[model samples]
Target: MNAAPSVRAVIARHCRELLADPLLHGDPTLRDIAAQCHQPLRVLLVGNVSTGKSTLLNALIAGPLAATAFEETTSSVTWYHGPEPADPVLPDPGHRSVTTDFPLAGRVMLGDSPGLNTLSDNPRETLRMLGGSDLTGAAAAFVCVLVGGRVDQWAEGLEELAAFSAGPFDLVGNIVAVMAKVDEVDEAVEDIERRVSGDTTATFRFAAVNQLMAAAARTGAVDDRIVATLDRLRTLPVMHGRSAPAWDRLAEEVGTALPPGHLKALEQVVGAPAWLPALVAATAGMTTTGAVAEQFERMSRIRSLEAVLSDLADDSDLFTSTAAVLRLRRLAARLKPRPAALVRARLADLTATMHTSGLHRRAAARLVRHTDVGSGLTEHERAAAQALLRWPDAGADGGGTSDRATAAEVDVGAVLARWTAYEADPFRDSRSREVAALVIETARHRLRTTTRQEES
Candidate 1:
């Protein structure tokens, strides 16, 4: 028996066959798509200016690929594929920059466009690039890095994805939302995920990552333990008065393992030792003298983004199928008497694979819109379902919905009463009753946790 063909092989075969078709060959766009399919999968990094789009790209592909940045040319779109480029050309070099050299270049072609909010019509270009499935290849997906703060504050930026995604007969997904520089924020990673989870129209997969630590991890200069140690030190209480001398000395002693450069950077970044987390935040800007690539790679949270990228790469066949369908549609679009039957037949073959594609699944993302109450389902229920799906024995491990909305924000007492009613409902079927019982238990646990917080 033969092993199933790899996604790359299938995509290559599909592109070759499509290119040979006399019908599509005449169209430059489809031909370009055919040519691009032969290249590695592309993941576009799109976000507003100074949201660290270029920095994140450098972290991901190890080239200041976004350096040929900003609105030097209205139609400029920098492609970072090939053997990996030389050190990044920074300060927007006033021209396009492209190179190959860093690792994973062949496996993935990364595109870093100018910021969405740049003076150059880059956002328009970005939308065009996103809409042009042929140019980016079917396997191309996007990472929409949102600025941290109120979702309402970044609503316009988040909504930009919808506009980019908007096109007749064009269904785009496989887009992930990543919160960048999350360490600078006051919220926990999980809370940010929760708040942003309300923005259903924007991103499907949401992750709050500390790219600084991720860069550290990738650089081999720092390990998870070191990051953890830095975090611990940042929180350590500093001594001041004469009575606090011993504690102050101990705090200094604990922080000694930190690199001198990192310490200095932290001092500069934080200004004064106001608190522990502040020190931790300062560690984010520390850079290695000779290890730009590794340094950026570790802490940039590029690894988290890469996991999604790799997933998209692994599903290259779906991308290929998606691209082929789009091409067919485009060809059909150009026809006076649209070849609906012909296009449908060609597209029909892809429906099964399309359903399984990450793009389609992403399109079907379960959005938890904010109402006047809790998100209906507690975090625990979500975890239990996940556990049951993945591995039953694993169960829930401190992963559940945090019912943080106060009674003032929404009627807390009424919410609990409903769950209680469901739990005690005699008319509920046995199966439903079992589920309700579980819900009741979860609510009770949540209330207890909330009570502890209030008491503390």
Candidate 2:
């Protein structure tokens, strides 16, 4: 039986054809880019060491394929895909890739990337997986899984999010943030949630997830209340004429039955009280059907993340395919004994068409940071652009905020004026004139874009 080659494979094949062509035998860069393009869309689980990144993947796949410990568990880049092979496949002596029929394996490959700032070779590996170098370009989106209530840790992940940007492809547009260990910061939940939701950084869809609670409720301890809550929700009409009691209150009843330490533990890793009922409902049976697995997935928010990934897959398909075509056609045009003039003209037209397509400009604009002007923009200016660009979609896609949910808005002109009058004067770093000009222009563009979006 013949099977279709994957998008990456097609790119690789094209590269081979081009390489073997008598007319284009000299250039190797084109071959290298084709090989890099062969990489599948790798969804990275990025964060600091030991933030339950691997454990969360295990819960997501409903298997313990990723080694998990209280400390840094992932040692290298591991890729997971569907349809288990007879044995493991290692692409390189240093890295491993495996096939498993996990719920998400079929749609896209999942990569468990070590913490980007780890002490070992992990950071280098993380960058390579994300295509974060000159030789490689990104064919991936990020799921920034962070431990609860730590702005510092979250900042580290955001650094990776921004770092993924290169040239005209803005991989940051594909990021989906996950607040891990939601249960650990009970006392300051409101404040921390405020901090995260309020962050002025890039606005991307986010989920406050407690993979531990989701896993525990489904596979480990069964709190009677969790079961009870699930049963109640199942019985009621999803949109009853009247309101239903809060699910957390129902879970609290189950919490009461457990020992104080156990209850505390439950509270430590439990996610939004809203998902409690669904978590228990997920594993209420000896075996799970597709429906049950789906329910569990939603409660775990893994399904939510998967849905996001699926949409991103479509986006990735468009972006990467167009990028591949443009890259190759451009190379072919530049090759010695280049194609017929008509063929070259068509290639240029096709490349231009790809550049102007949907979301392409906005995505490219995101790469401004790689430019001298963008890098010179003050941190405040850059953040302002992020908030403005994201406000329209972020409100819709990013999960609802709690008491601290309101976006901590920024005011740039006011900030800039202060900089102008600062005690020592700002921008005395020798690029003062250049920095100010870029900052003003960037802020103006951001302001106009935001205003136009709001009006629409």
Best candidate, TM-score: 1
For candidate 1, what is the TM-score? 0.54
Q: Candidate 1: misplaced stretches above 4 Å?
A: 6-26, 63-65, 68-75, 82-104, 132-139, 150-173, 198-203, 210-300, 335-456
lDDT of 1 by residue, 1-456 (tens): 122333334443544565566644544554445544556655677777766566566656553334433224324556576543343322122324466655556556676665666566567656656564334333256777776644666656555654444222123345667787675576656687787777554444565555444443443435444454555454555432222223345447666665545544433222223333433454654444334334434444466667666545544444444554555566556654533444444455444452323233212111211111113457543333222211111111111123322222333344456656655656655534444444444445546766897999
Tens-digit lDDT track for model 2 on 275-327?
44434445455233344434544555555666667655534543354445545
Ten-residue segment with the worst summed lDDT in candidate 2?
397-406
Local error of candidate 2 at residue 225 (angstroms): 13
Cα lDDT, model 2, residue 218: 40
Top-lDDT structure, candidate number: 2
Error of 1 at 277 (Å): 4.6
TM-score of each: 0.54, 0.53
